[model samples]
Target: MVDVVACGELLIDFTPVQQKEKPGSIAFEQNPGGAPANVLAALSRFGKRTSFIGAVGNDVFGRFLQQTLIRLNIGTKGLVLTEEAHTTLAFVHLDETGDRSFHFYRNPGADIMLREQDVNEALIAQAAIFHFGTLSLTHEPARSATWRAVEYAKQHQRLLSFDPNIRASLWEDLEEAKALALKGMAKADIVKLSEEELAFLVGSEDVVEATAWMLGQYDLQAVFVTLGEKGCFYRTRNNFGTVGGFQVTAIDTTGAGDAFVGALLYQLLEVGESMLDIPQATLEDMVRFANAAGALTTTRSGAIPAMPTLSEVKSFMEAAR
Candidate 1:
């Protein structure tokens, strides 16, 4: 059985190589990316049986994306290649702090053209976890596809993993984005959010209270709030703690959060179905390992291309201590 199955966008990210210092000119390199795709790529590096359910175009760029995922051993049986629209492309701009801003070129890209009928229930039901983000909810057909898959996962009792991975520029309406994000949260058993996303949901910057409110408002088993350079905070029904971040001079922050989430899920899979029963100490150790994975990712560039392997993450963790 597949350990995890994710349904969302699979697109290319053109990341700039030169920063503010090189003001004369800027250069970009095409990288395989997408929030859900990045997570699956990170898991695949750790030898997890992961599958992705999404769409790309039938064009050359889409072919490159398909081959990249296949090379990483991510199942693409649920991937739809359509001629209805060209593949989506995102241009990434990284600031001096390594934080990123995005500009997307998707006037109804092939990813958003994913129809409800394109989602395969049999393929999704084989996985223990169903992962998704609100990016798929910005447009139709894909929105319907996402909802159908969520319902199928619920019926099959798969662990629902939600990451808002919110990029507000993609949403036409801020209120609608909030409402749709909350809708996804309601269906999630496990949530991983960036600090900004947490504040968006709770309307407060206080993470402790926001996490507490989320755990109470929804029947969530666990909540993880990623704090970038500060590492991350995780809370379960019975336990909560802050795991300090690894020290690294980050060059690019893209896919770092996805790497962290993927590492956490990798540890969860190793523990089998009894996830909530994991010891608090063991949970903290897992968070540290994940933080290492994320920090290592930032030292490099791109999304899927920069994801560190299990051995690399372990070595980073060991050397950090």
Candidate 2:
């Protein structure tokens, strides 16, 4: 059985890099990206069997992304290549603090073209967890496809993992985006959100209050709010706590949150439905390991390339202690 199955956008990220030949000029480095894909990459690094269900263009970038997944040992049986549109591209701009923003080149990218027919029900049924993000909900056929897969996974009793991973600029209406994200959250068994996303969704700055509201609002097993280098706040129905982060001199924050989600899911999958009953200490340790994974991803540059191996995360955590 597949350990995890993710359905959503798979695209290229053009991360800014310093041009060595010309010191003042900057260059863009192509990296395999997309929140769902990055999460699978992180899981793959930890020796989990993962599969992707999404669409890409029948172009160079699409081919590259497919190969990247294969190289990462993630299954591609559900990945589709289409001629209708080119692959999606995002130019990443990093500030002095390694925090980043994106400018997208996807008016109708291939990812958005994913049809309900492209969704692999068999793949979803074979997985222990079904993971997705809201990016695919921004457009048509992909939106329907995502919901179809979600329903199928739910019917099969698979754990549903969600990350809103909202890019407000991609939406025509922020409120619409918010609604869809909340809709997805309501369906998820596990959810991960950035600090900004938590505030945006809950309309509260207090993590404790917001998480309480979320647990009360949704039929969720657990909710994680990632706070960059400060680590994460997590809450389940019965327990809640903060996990302190590892201090890392981050060069790029890309994929860090996905790494945290991946690591947390890896641990959660070990216990399955019992995750809801795990002790607060067990939950904190899981988040601590996930925080280490996220911090380690930032020490490098790209998304998939930067994800640490299982051994690397273990060694980093050991050394930090």
| Alpha-carbon TM-score of each model against the true structure | 0.97, 0.98
- Candidates in order have lDDT scores of 0.92, 0.93
Model 2 regions more than 4 Å off? none
Q: For each candidate, how many residue pairs have backbone atoms clashing (under 3 Å)?
A: 0, 0
Tens digit per residue, CA lDDT, model 1, 114-179 = 889999888788999999999999999899999999999999999999999998988999889999
What shift in Å separates residue 123 of candidate 2 from its native position after superposition? 0.5
| lDDT digits (tens) for residues 241-287 of candidate 2 | 88899998999999999999999999887656467789888899899
| Candidate 1 residue 53 C-alpha distance from true site, Å | 0.5
For candidate 2, give the lDDT of residue 45: 91
Winner by lDDT: 2
